[model samples]
Target: MFIRTENPQTFIKFYPVTVAILVLQIAIWTIYLLPLPSVQMWSNLMTGFNLGIAKGEWWRFLTPIFIHASFSHLLFNSFSLFLFAPALERMLGKVRFFLIYIGSGLVGNIGTYLIMPLEYMHVGSSGAIFGLFGVYVYMVLFRTDLIDRANSQILLTILVISLLMTLINQQVNMIAHIFGLFGGLAFAPLLLNKKSDGF
Candidate 1:
């Protein structure tokens, strides 16, 4: 027996770009994980404080988002990004979505730099994924229809799941997730509004 589902076109349309970007990121990291000198050299480029904005290595802020410590780590993060990003991109448009992704990742890195000791090394896209969740929650909260109610429930569900996951997995960077959420919350209003607010 076949089960009929509501519109799956959204899922189908987004898979290509999301999957391609994530696959490329995974492939690059896989190469970097290899012991080859070339791979090692490439890997060194993403070390947190080794290359940082304070040191004029601004790219490191963004580069770390694409780097993962293990295959499972990469898979989990990439899958989350793939799942949520397309819907956000469709709603916010490519430019806004890209800004949210990069901005949140940078905010996450900044939080790490401030909270963790300088020698501590960290990398993952979880920060950005959390940012996407934050944005979705914000959008849902502002809506006034039945969809809004549904989305609010979804947001609450995600929060509960995040809490559970963080509690269960000590390796997860809960601090980064919190920081990314705050970053997205702070930025969304400014970006979404047309009126100019003096800073």
Candidate 2:
């Protein structure tokens, strides 16, 4: 019943943070889709441009995840969040979820910035999504009962496919994806619940 419901409130109650992020992405994209020529400027302000960071415009470290370069990029990220984020939110609860999401995203962006050319620009929620995947992998290992065997296999399969895709695609920022995952793994030990001792 929970999986197939028409009630928006049900979704909000169980997946508040996920729903909020989805709404934020949609609102941003709505602006991106507008006819005004100024719309392109959003990316300029939001993208993770190393040059901007070097100049002490440090917010670029976190803002890039909200800016998507293409419709397909946004679509895939939205789908990934809608499909996986709610379960992760439930697994880690609200505070840990928030911390892990942002922390991993920062790590991903920092990793990319260190290696990527200064003039290069990167945008999209892929790093945060990878963080979600990383957190889920940790859950599978330490919080097994929360995720059944089927979901564990599915998560593992997703991680493998994502890694392969990162390797094969030259345009993709493998640094962000790889480090985002590692960042999540590292956070799990400190943030993930080891027992029923409250997350």
Candidate 3:
């Protein structure tokens, strides 16, 4: 399910939302890498700073979903989205997928703001990517019609590995990963209740 079978032309046309998100992430990361002071300042401003959120900079929650701490961070998330997101986008349609994507990220950031120390700060789309995992989990467990047994098993294995990695990776925001996952599970039923188009 995670494989990229679609060629560039078809992928762009079929999964515009996923493509757009990948483009936005890369563009923002590119600007963030610039040596200019203004770019650095802007990048700093966009991170998920718990103190900044407490200071009423609420946009930090949303903006951090697109920002990454390093080229590897951006590339990993972008590649994950490129490979895995298109299926959900195809199944859920553009609008609902976008809502889940952003909403899950917000849930992660808000959870971080509420739980983390005021001095804490973070950036990356791991929360959002994990949110996608949650959605797939929901499918594996409840919405069996959406995914076959073989694919479900594969997803479960990946999910286990992912959670293990999240725990092992000291740099990752554990709260955001956990919260974003629940966020996706929380959003799944409501969003998936309606009939979705099969990919």
Best by TM-score: 3
| TM-score against native, each model | 0.80, 0.89, 0.96
RMSD of each: 5.6, 2.7, 1.2
Better of 2 and 3 by TM-score: 3
For each candidate, what is the lDDT?
0.69, 0.81, 0.88
**Per-residue CA lDDT of candidate 3, range 10-44, in tens?**
99999999999999989988777678999989988
Clashes of each: 0, 0, 0
Candidate 1 per-residue C-alpha lDDT over 113-132 given as tens digits, one digit per residue, 9 for 90 to 100: 77876566777888877877
Model 1, which residues run further than 4 Å from truth?
A: 1-20, 50-56, 144-147, 193-199
Q: What tens digits encode model 2's per-residue C-alpha lDDT throughout 146-195?
A: 56787788789878998999999887778999888888888887887755
